[model samples]
Target chain A: MKFVLALVALVALAFVPSFAGPYPLGLGIGVLGYGVLATAWAMFSGPTRYISLATVAFFGLGAYTVAVLSETLPYPVVLFVAAVIGLVVALIVGLATLRLAGIYFVIFTFGLTELVRQLVTYYEVNVTRTLGRYVFLPLGPEHIYWQLLALLAATLGMAYWVRQSRIGLALRVIGDDPVVASHLGIRITRTKLTLFSISCVIMTLAGAIQAPRWTYIEPSIVFNPTTSFLVVIMALLGGPNRLFGPLLGAVPLFLLFEWLSANFPNHYSIILGLLFIAIVFVLPNGVLAAGESLWTRLSRREART
Target chain B: MTTISRRTVLQGMGVSALATALSGLPVLAQDRTAIRIGYAISKTGPNAAGAGISTTPNYLLWVDDVNKAGGITLSKLGVTLPIEVTEYDDRSTAEETVRAIERLATQDNVDLILPTWGTGANLASGPTFDRFGYPQLAGTAVTDMAPDLVKRWKHSFWMLGGGHDYAEALVALLVKQRDAGTINNKVAIASVADGFGIDLSKAATPAFTEAGFELVYDKTYPLGTSDFAPVISEVAGLGVDTFVAFSYPPDTFALTQQSVVANFSPKVFYLGVGTAFPIYPGIAGPNHNGVMGIGGIDPDSEALAAYFERHTALNGQAPDNWASAVTYASLEILAQAIERVGDIDREAISAEISSGEFDTIIGKVKLVDNQLRSLWTVGQWQDGKFVGLAHTERAGAREPVVPKPAWVPAA
Candidate 1:
């Protein structure tokens, strides 16, 4: 029944391009792009409680791939290559850094992102001799929206499948206590690596899909560390434990940012920073957990009456 | 239990409704009497410094002046329309820049749109402006790709010439100095490892080599490097008579300060980007004199003096001596083109801009191939003012001071 409902929702979302004009479609593209990223992020970080900040590393790699190959190859082929490159890089990075836990993992991932950005910058300066590249693909905003919608659906489906599967059980165990999971014969490294690779591939695809929206890209623009931070914040704020937490968190937060930025161009950053502080203090467990608690109190009062 | 929460649904609905109302308001307003001009600029992030100094101030001054003069004339409509401005801060990101531009076009239904801050944002937004049929007179964007980009986006015009233009002009000036026996041919070059610096250095290296100047030391430091002591000491030790740094503002300030401390005074010292800024004299004091850089302005132009006075009065800061006047000039061209067309028809405005020449603060302006051919590529500090030293067309250029005076700290 739930699967059917989600399928219905996905199909409904796919029709948004038909009614919406370019403005709304552009906002939708932003929402869907972050939706996939936050969802994919939760799929790995929520289960293991390892905060990975390398999202932009894979995302930028994907964008750069599409930029370098979009002129030479078909759109679909370039997207596939972007995903493949993302997966390979994720596997290597995951193997190297997944052994560390807690803040160590977070710091390492952040370092990895900066490292990759520097490498790309170096290559562009010393090799290509141009710091910025122009991407002239035949993709419109509608095309981007549809593709991101599809990617978001796939990400949600995969998150759900991982939650129900044996790997999900093992991940939960590992999150609870890693030593017990290892004693339970869970291949901790392998399970973590596989999930991380899958999540990173989705991030890469999201980047590749959205690259054409920014017709010109450079290392600093695409590999911005702000992207990784936003994904983390959205997932955590939505209650990463829930399957739809990131989406619930992403939609409203993305809209809020769009609104704040539009309404208060000069002071939006200050307002946004205050809002993030409020979210951390007021809804530490995320909006989903807060809602669940509110529902529990209401129902209990109803039963007493 | 369903994963969709009641609160999420309520918030989403509220946002959707608000978005609908916002987009629908412009259509419902029956009186569309004003010419709505929109732009997305970097008001808050890393790019804000440049936008604040060079781009945004000119825009604010131009709009205020135009409105004070009873707005733009539309001869075809037999009426002059007051301008209504809609601006968004792009937060110095390309994604936000593109989205804001799209919103200006489709949502606010703005008649004219100005270009955004830097090379990347302006280039990123080309296809969007083309799609929406708005003319983009990019003021601050300088790239070797301008000729091709102009062809690609017909409505777009580049004010600042390519990196090669600046490099060629500076090299020609240096060759002239060398011929006068004022300086030797040894040059030390350092550039910031980014688009602006890389482009300038790449152009300058070849130009210098072609002019038979030997490169003594050439290297690039990362973007955010604060410590220039090592780089400055290394270059200072090389005993090069000519030292050129294609650096950004932060690096430029830092390099100048450290060079003063290290006493690395080359006879011919040139820094990029910020050297021609109004603030350079204030920051560098006596050291600013005879220091040449990327852009020059004709200090003798009476129109330019008035522009500077008005800009300083309104913005509480003098505009950068380089791109600020050109930016204001681009607006002059836009206004003239609009008056010529006598309507808000973007196609007509773009055509008029492409074909017509106009008098501006920068003097008789014309774009040969959708680019402003009249540009100052080199300027130097003389008698406490950053003034134009060379032009692309070899006209209206002042004679450069040779063998810059020894560094002296301000009392």
Candidate 2:
């Protein structure tokens, strides 16, 4: 029943650009892009209990890949190259930091983004002699929206598949107790690295699809650390335990951002900060979990009556 | 037991999102009697300080002034239309700036579009405005890419002097000072590590070397740097007699504050962008005297005095020394172009702007190939006021104070 409903939702989203205006379509594109980032991130980080804060590093890698290669290659081929780059970089980073855990791993991944940002900044300044690359893709708002939606669908499908697979069970065991999982014959290192690499590939593909919308790519804008933090916050806010939780968090959160930015442009950040604090304090588990609790309580009351 | 499925929640969200989007449609309707001019400015971000003094107030003043006289008189149409401004705070990010410009163009369908706050924002939005066929008369953008951008985008015009031009002018003044034995040949230069600062530094570095000045200390700091004491101490340790800082507003204030704390006083201390702002003098106090920076106005002009009074009356603050005149002058140019063409057709207005000359508060304004050719490239602070020291044409240029007086201690 859930599968059938999910399929219907995906099909409906695929046709959104047909009826929606450019503004809504643009907002949809942003929401879908964030959905991919948050969902794919939650897919690996949720089950493994490893907080990966390097979303922007992969996102920027993909954006720059498209920025540099899109001029010569097709858009789809550029996305493929970006995914490959994301996979390779994530494999190296995951291996080097796999031994570390807890706050150390979080800090390492956070530092990785800043290191990558500075390196890219230096390369652009010294080698390119240009402030940023100008992307001249012919894709319009609708095309970009469709591309982002397709990526989101693929990401959600992957997450659902991962949730049902044997590897998902193994990841959950490791997240619960790594020593016990290892003693039970689970290959902890390889499985975690694989999941991390796959998640990064999805993130990079999303970034590649969204890059043309920007039309120009600079290191600071593309590789912003704030984007990485926003992805993690969205996942945590939506409930990282469930596959669709991040999507639920991302859509409404992004819409709220757009609405607040349009209305209270000056106080948008402050309002957003307060909302984040309120969610953390009240809905500690996430909005999805809180809603489920409310539903459960109401059903129990009805049953009692 | 009743349960809420994830699918149900997703469907509900989709319905609500659609409803919200549909409801947002009515806000974009056009007002026919008003000439809608849209702009994305940095009202509350890193670039806010620059935009606060240089761009936004001038825009408001222009709108108020135009509407006060009933409206802009279109000689060709024999009718007047009041100006209506649609503004969005860009949050000082390129992505937000681009999105806001896109909204203004595609959603709002504004009659004319103003430039974003800084060089990067302007460059990011240039293609969008060009694609939409809106005339972009940039006010605060300063980049050497202006020539290429103007050529690439037909409707775009760069109002300020190019970075290379300004760098060359500053270097020329330094060379003159060096030749006159006003300052030593050794200099220290620092720049903010953004597009604007990087471009200025890149242009000035070679120019300084080519003009026979030894760069004793050189480095670039990141934007929003709170501590300049370390860099200032290093520059001071180099025993350099001249200091040149390519900076934005925040860093301009930070560097000056740190320099005073460290007592890193150079004989010729020249900071960029924000040095010409009124707040710089107000904050730096006695230390502001003898400092030189980018852009200037004729301090003695009655027009400038009147602009200051009107700006203070309207906005409760004085305009910045550098881009305020140029920003207002660009609006004046736009108003005159609209009057000449007598319509809001973007192509006609762009053509008139490309071919026409108009008198403004800044004097006779003419664009050579869509770039402002004759303007003050540099200014120096003397007696608490920024006076134009270098102009493209030296006719009305004020003589720069040589061997700048020592920094006075705060009272």
Candidate 3:
């Protein structure tokens, strides 16, 4: 854990310079963003086992909310405004879909995202044009990097705090056996609702952070299905069930994408796809989870001997 | 994929498009033994229709004309090297495009790289070529942000005008019309939500204001939209006379088709870019008889007709305004750059584009302050043809072609 903390701190420090150069900085910022999103997703899916798929709904709503509100205030204030909007959106979405399980949850969330995207694109709103013309924020280099860092930490910090809390215990119990948890006097529905809302807020914040990076908000990129898939894949491939999983997952995957895109062009997708398939079959418990278990077992055997 | 009749195709291509297709093959390499160039374009996908119509045909004609005139002289090798083109299909995705460029620069290692079709595809591949420092000559992509985008990523350059050209030219065309007493009404703008669409959509304010027309309706939708009923109905409700369509092929087809079905005929319908397709008129039937646009090379011009005749025979399709002319002109600029630089080293060629004078089909073209110097003109659809309607001196026809003043009950 100390090693991981030190590594993360060093990487975060190194990331400030990424904002200085265009190519390196852009890729760095993007990878960091996905890392944050993947981390949030891992907590919900790893222990909760609900397969929450409304990441898009939360992200898109948050993005538009920030863009529309920031027209009149600073991005920080706009983010708070978006959190309020996201809370309402999540409440409606959660109350309707949180009861469903497994595949049902996935499909419902998918449809919800598409609906949100369509509404954003077609529906006309009566909001003032305070954002004026530019949809992007104007910030200096240090400010953007600091904002991004703080946003990332806030998302991670909240997710970690929830995972360690009593509600997290209830979620774990619900994942293992919902009926038993109910028999044990745990209010599963209320717990799931609370978790869903929190999960959505975290995802919304991720979108808020992302909007400034592109400086343009469109229903497509915000509600992008690809983003949902990336987060899920990162979490699952890293150690899914662990706190360090998503960060670990995003590193190798993004590296693979960048390297192949730069060097082999044609073989980029082929290599990434093959690697993903290999990982899925061979590393059932993911890289960190399985590797850690193997090391612990080896040390235990040596102690016994 | 049925064979397009040469005569029928020629009837449309006439002179401008044909000459555009044939006119700009590289003057045999002055120092090297051979000139090898690469083209990265989509050979298959939803947008492939435009690629097939525009870039691919003109490429075949340009290469064929040069090869027929004997092998290209290569200055670097101190001998002329017959032109050899290696074409790769990007599958119309940004990731695929990036990968394709990497292969072109490192493996097949062609001297010149032709621009891919769409903005997103180019955006994906643009950074990779910049990383390796290659001279990329894009034939058809229109985004103002693209120049700044490439400058940030570093090396790749563009030849054909970007999206700013389309919107600015429409404003120029409308301003001319308003001054000439050709139109007296509100302006409506319809753009999509793709790469350059959002930018162009927002561009209506300046353009409409410059032309002195009140912007009545400014609407944007997603790219794959197959129907324009709801939007066109809204535009009709606004009672607009001049409509600016900032759309690509698929949505272009939809908007034009639906506008006709809705009976919402703006007096001067400005289909800025997408309707530049020759197939558009054939697709829209009589509805396309007098639509206005910004495709300078007329389909009926003599030079363009020969291009259609030859291109139809070879590539099995008719040449459209956006697809063939822009792509051909890009290659023309690229070949000329190579000739002037006298070497295949990527740095010198890129510097030449980044630094000097270039005259191509679009006339006296060059990269000024990382944007275009000229090329914001207009074209109009007359009798099922997209004719050059502005920036004359090349087929030289500039004017609007719908709802003549005689037809309007004198406002």
Top TM-score model? 1
Question: What DockQ does each listed candidate score?
Answer: 0.50, 0.32, 0.04
Off by over 4 Å in 1: B1-26, B409-411
Q: lDDT of all predictions, in order shown?
A: 0.89, 0.83, 0.65
lDDT at A282, model 1: 64
lDDT of 2 by residue, A1-305 (tens): 98899889888988888887666677787788899999999998988778888999998998889989998998778888898899999999989997788889899999999888888777766666455677878887788788888888888888888888988889899999999999999999998988898999998888888777776677777887878888887887799989889988898878767766766777878987876776676666777897888889879999999
Q: What's model 1's overall lDDT?
A: 0.89
* CA RMSD per model (angstroms): 2.6, 3.7, 11.7
The window of 10 residues in a row where model 2 chain A has the poorest summed lDDT is A123-132
Cα distance off (Å), candidate 1, residue B215? 1.3
Every candidate's chain B TM-score: 0.95, 0.92, 0.80
Winner of 1 and 3 under TM-score: 1
Winner by DockQ: 1
True contacts kept of each: 0.63, 0.24, 0.00
What's each prediction's clash count? 0, 0, 42
- Residue-level lDDT of model 1, residues A146-238, one tens digit each, is 999989988988999999999988998999999999999999999999999999999999999999999888998999999999998899889
Give the clashing pairs for model 2.
none
